[model samples]
Target: MDKDDQPERTVTKPQARVVDPPPDSEATLIRPPPAPKPPASPAPRKDSGNQLPVGTFLGEFEITELIGEGGFGIVYLARDHSLQRRVALKEYMPSALAARTGPLEVSVKAERYAETFDAGLKSFVNEARLLASFDHPSLVKVYRFWEANGTAYMVMPYYEGVTLKQKLKEMGAPPNEAWLLDLLGPLTEALLVIHADQCYHRDIAPDNVMLLKGTGRPLLLDFGAARRVIGDMTQALTVILKPGYAPVEQYAEVPGMKQGPWTDVYALAAVVYYAIVGKTPPPSVGRLMNDNYEPLSQLAQGRYSPKFTAAIDRALIVKPEERTQSIEELRHDLGLDTMAPAPRPAPAPAPARPAPAATAAAAAPSAPAKKGAMVAVAGLVALVLAGGVGYALLGRDAPAPAPGAAAPAPPAPEPASAAVATAPPPAPVAEPAPPPPPPAAIEARFDPLQDFERVAAGQSADFGVEAATAKPQFRIDRDYLSFTVKSTREGHLYVFLHGSDGVLVQVFPNAASRNNKLRAGQTITLPPPQSSWAMKASGPAGTDHFIAIVSAYPRDFGAIGLKVQDGFGMASAEAVAEAARAQGGAAPLFLGKPVCSGDCVDRYGAALFSSQQIP
Candidate 1:
């Protein structure tokens, strides 16, 4: 704990303003002060002060070790050297409320927690600029974030895999309920992009998630509103709450204690009840004073289903107004579907509000809300309401805060059954929905940013379906969709499609399918995983967006700015992401360079989209 000694770092050399002599004859050429630019880095010393030991570097990454330590941050594995690989990084350091006098400095341990440590460093740089504009693959890609020596870090991508709490401790029990809903259906579409940016991972447990290795996918890691902004900057840090996956309004801040996405929908239905009955489910303050927690449709009744044990017992209702507060109604009672086809209609049950007649023999079903699928992100926004969980102070399994306790009473009114039902968004289909039920199974998953914000809102957003599957629309010029790209590491992708003058063309390995490489986990598939034109297309219909773009090296999308639109056509998607950020963030055809971290050009692509109408 010997931290303090770090002071010398002053290099303020920007004084070049003294120019008088341009009246059409006077001479005054003086430009010699530019040579003092060598100190752009290397100043934040004291590595051992707050710890960055193993080969410490921080600029081109290097640290190579210590990958754990929590009450806020400190990860590390490092390496990077301008991308030769290996990263992880992290480091916000709230260890009992800050220290490190250097190696990128941090201080606050007292000064009365400095306005809650600058509101938990402005909520950890606004959840790292909204999880670096999330582009899901199950999450965790964020390749950059910095500050130098005062705090903040991030970096990411070192993933190798394994933590569904060590794959449920090397499979000693519980997993295959259709492989835990295909790894929680891409973590329920990456928690619908962190509740579509209103935010709230509020710690999900199963040790924050992971899984990756050979593309077993399932990402979501560390984020309980980033330890409640380090439990609001030091009450000696504590509040990492988990007791059977926190929910009695995350154990209290009082005056109507709240948290939404039914508080990470009761810790993601108690991490799917500890991944199918290995343990943990009783403690929402002991199921609000006496529930004994049984009821995965009455104890795993027939291995699971009754709408997946009634969406994990109405998201383990110990009452947050009787539970299941959106993740699109717990991914429609675990059946899943929200951003795609819309006539969006499933949520309307949980308000019996005052609980207890034993809830008249244990009730359920209040999950509604979905009509006309809108999805816009940031501004020009339309839907994503689950954003009201403000005022926080919640904690449990302590380091402090157990000194008064109080909360455990809220659960007295009861009745029977009427809420917990879901399956509604299919009736609004203008096309693709009926042909997917019989022996024709092929769903792959979709939501390329909710079809690029539903074709930047002029509407028509669905995009070729089949990848972990979901469809109820998309069929204008005679539907024909297919996809498969299977890479866990083998680099080089670039696919693009987006037709009907919506523009984006590139399509397949190009030169009519040739060199896009990709091997690792194999699979490939689009019209050339073995060719034959299976991805069908035609006239000026409506939505398309296939896209892809994976990397590890192989860029050049028309030398980075990809103007297209002449015949390659892409007139929208924010005018090809503002012509890939008007190419000055140093070459960006929609974001690149090891998954962009800062001045983020755009991050290339991932897309899925599939809707079409004018038939």
Candidate 2:
């Protein structure tokens, strides 16, 4: 297909008046209006419609070759003369509205498109400016942008990598959950960041995700903001949205049906669906009608976890309101606590009227609303009641009778084993007891290590730990704790101490010894004699859990946005989770801890040891 005749879209007009390009240090050299081509000149390639020739100069950039073309613009590999580096230069040339009339000049294809083309150009530059403000590894960074030759261009890093689409095609099979989750870690973090600034990708297909060479770190490309602007103006929905990947909201805007983070969530889920099922889900709009979309839970059964599949299903919900509303919600549902510790959990959806069996089941301890320690407490209460224990032994005052209501008589005590068998069937008039309050309503220690352990369960490496203290049970401010960690595979090692004092700190990979690389079968000791730091037992007088992990890949705590305390990176499970959630998009700090795609095995190991802290 010829690039010139390809489908294209236009940008939406900004509410504010369009402004001229800001002054740039590098002056543009304009060429005169185009003249008739010489009869002897060779014809241009069909796909090379109005693109600049190789070696064509635009400001400080020298075009080397055309890299890609879309409805809204053209991308070129260029030499940044000023920086002495290679760059991916993008030109705001909407093919449907504008053309390169002169060697370096872009003009509207027809007089009627003049205003539409100009509006799109402004939006393109603005979008570039917005992208430049973001500093995330997953997002493509725009170094500079300017207007020249009646058009605008933005310079970005010439990243070396293939698209997720291309990579998947070569692999010839769906990626595994860990690999998908690993990919999602950074991508979601990036999306959350942009979405925080009220920017939406709107276009998050596999092709838009570039996996960097060697590292496989993802770089988001071709955001829809500028493309959307032109797309809306041209009323070219088909050209703007990639089918199957796009949600129903993108097909047509309706009351209460609009684009937001969930829109991107749906697209991302669709991408995952493509990776796992070997095809995108049925188009979201079609699902809204006949609703033939099969849940990932059914198709990907045994291949992926229920939590992972359910989250994707929720995000792909046809109605925006019913769908996973934000990436934070999706992350939590997917069990990637990589986001900040305490984002206000998404409100539970209004429950449907349940049948008698479901109502009884809902009141059972296994209910989803009861989490962590709360469930354990509920189980204990049920056991005590079944044992026919005195009310006072239950350790809580019972509520007084309702105002103006008669006090009910106490029921006859029943034996522990016969409690369920002897109880009368629930009456039709009786209401199901309300579920216990969620954990957040009460004082609960937020253990971040639990989240860390959950992620680490997916890793497969042989790790062993041995901890020795200067004293029997480390006395606060008196004794120091030293631990030895050994792994069967050579990899980066990370050690964290979750002190009973309610603080978490990275012990290894600290300022004293930043290099955490450990050789296979090598036994490494923390707080080596050569280091400037020591792991002195701290107080609060409780157990201190020391976690040691040797990962195939080095972890980057920058995504956690933790600050150095003394010489080591200090963080709380609460603080890190909150930061991860806020980061919205960040590369995984420990890729080895998560599940990998295909037959890919992330070789990593972890061991945890506990010691008492005394005053």
For model 1, residues 68-135, the per-residue Cα lDDT tens digits are 77666778786543222455778777766678765456888778866776677666656665666676
Question: Native-vs-model 2 lDDT?
Answer: 0.56
What is the number of residue pairs that collide in model 1? 49
Model 1, C-alpha of 89: deviation from truth (Å): 18
Misplaced by over 4 Å in model 2 are 1-48, 338-615
Task: Please name the candidate that would achieve the greatest TM-score relative to the true structure.
Answer: 2
Segments in model 1 whose C-alpha atoms lie over 4 Å from true places? 1-105, 108-130, 136-144, 153-187, 191-202, 205-238, 246-266, 270-280, 284-291, 296-305, 308-333, 337-340, 346-615
TM-score versus the correct structure, for each prediction:
0.25, 0.49
In model 2, what is the error at residue 108, expressed in angstroms? 0.5
**lDDT per residue (tens digit) for residues 1-615 in model 2:** 001221111110000011111222121211221111222123344566877767665533567789888777889987643223456888888888888776667899889988788778778877777876786778877765655567877777677778889988887767677667667877888898999998889899999998875456677888856678777888988778898998888888889988899999999999999988888888887887799999999998997899889999998888899999998998889877654322222221211111111000100010011111111233322111111111111111122211110111111111111001111112112223454532221113123433333233324413322222223255655666565566656777776654322235555564334566778767666655534444454343444445566666554444443344323445443344344333333222322122234664555656544445456
The 0-to-1 C-alpha lDDT of every candidate, in the order given, reads: 0.47, 0.56
Clashes of each: 49, 25
